[model samples]
Target: MAQLQTAVSMIYPPRCTTCGDLVESDFGLCGPCWRETAFLGGAICDACGVPLTSGGKDGVFHCDTCMQDPPPWVQGRAAVIYRGNGRKLVLALKHGDRQELARPAGVWMANMVRNLVSKDTLVVPVPLHWSRLLRRRYNQSALLGAEVAKNLGVSFCPDALLRRVRTPSLEGLSHEARMVALEKAITPHPKRGHRLDGKPILLVDDVMTSGATLKACTNACFDAGSGPVRILTLARAVKEA
Candidate 1:
């Protein structure tokens, strides 16, 4: 299949996800777009994975935001800093029906958190409300989580988390309101036999903004017997300093 994809790419070169420029590989951005994407690296929050300007003491760093109010998950990692092109690629995947970008996004996500994955790990995705799922015709996180699990050779449970409640859109809500709205929105899949059973879980998502949604999802996983939940998103929104 990879060979076939290569052949197809040779015939019809794959274009960038954010821009139409021809890139060397599939589901990627051109050099300029790549540069424009602020890939997160270097020192970051030990809990939430926000890049830090100054190196921390004793090799343990927690951003001020996380220090004040930590996330429910054990740790987190994001592939790109959500701003210009990162935002574009994420929007393309979320609302533009560019499902093809999931492969590369998953690849980047897998690479970002390969150390967190193991044979016993359970890869799950943040659930979408049925209404939104029906309207979107796909769950981008499920696509990303499946590909990530395949790349890491771990168990992928697309329905591990279920969005039982369909709430209003989270956009434009205050942080506190967003937190309240996301409460009880996501819960573990009620399938009787499938339990996390102390297994580590990698929660996948397309993007993380205030992380309220991911927090709700993480709490659900913990309540379902999942252990040491870690997060990985394609992009994370950060305001300018």
Candidate 2:
């Protein structure tokens, strides 16, 4: 296996996932791409995982948006802010059919949410409607979630949540409108829903914008008796002030 891998590497050297530049490792960004990416660090909100200006007095923190409209999940985290190379990586994985990006993205998410994991934690991905799934040929969130579960050594329920309604594109919609469009659009899967009962759930996604989708997924888990749900995403879209 090692010899075959070496032969393959020699034949086709590994390149950066973002830029086409060669990198020493596989499934990663080049140095320039790495530095340009807005990987989240320092203080962040407990509810939405948006970067905060400062840490909280008591170790728990939430951004103003989260404070005003709290999310359904108990905690949240993100690997990067949605901009520059971070956004590029998310879009590549989500729409460019770059499925290999899931490995590194999932590892990043697992590391970000490491403190939240437990023996009974079940990793789940936000679902796509059947129509979208058929059109896209894959649910990017599920790939990320599966990798996260593998890295974390936890159980994964890819179908724990089902999208009952296919809503239109959420772009250009106000947060309120997005919420209305997603209301009850997601629910616990009848057959797989039982796996979520009383288990701590780690909800995974590629990007979090208005968070309406993640909120709906969290509520579905709650409806199925899921315990203390937490969310993790590859990137979080930060709104301009």
Best by lDDT: 2
C-alpha lDDT score of every prediction, in listed order: 0.86, 0.91
| Candidate 2 lDDT, 1-241, residue by residue in tens | 9999999999999999888899998887889988998988778898888999875868878898888888888999999999989888888898999999999898888999887789789999999999999999999999999999999999998999999999999998998999999999999998999999999999999999999889889989999999799999999999877
Which pairs clash in model 1?
A: none
**What is candidate 1's CA lDDT for residue 39?**
91
Put down candidate 1 lDDT per residue, 1-241, tens digits, no spaces: 9899888988999788777888886777888888888998888887777788785889767889888898888889998988898888888889999998899888888988887667898889898888889999999999999989988889888887888889788888988999898888888888821566587989999988888898998888888877888999999888788
- Cα lDDT for residue 74, model 1? 80
Query: What TM-score does each of the candidates earn?
Result: 0.93, 0.97
* Regions of candidate 1 where Cα sits further than 4 Å from its true position: 1-7
Best by TM-score: 2
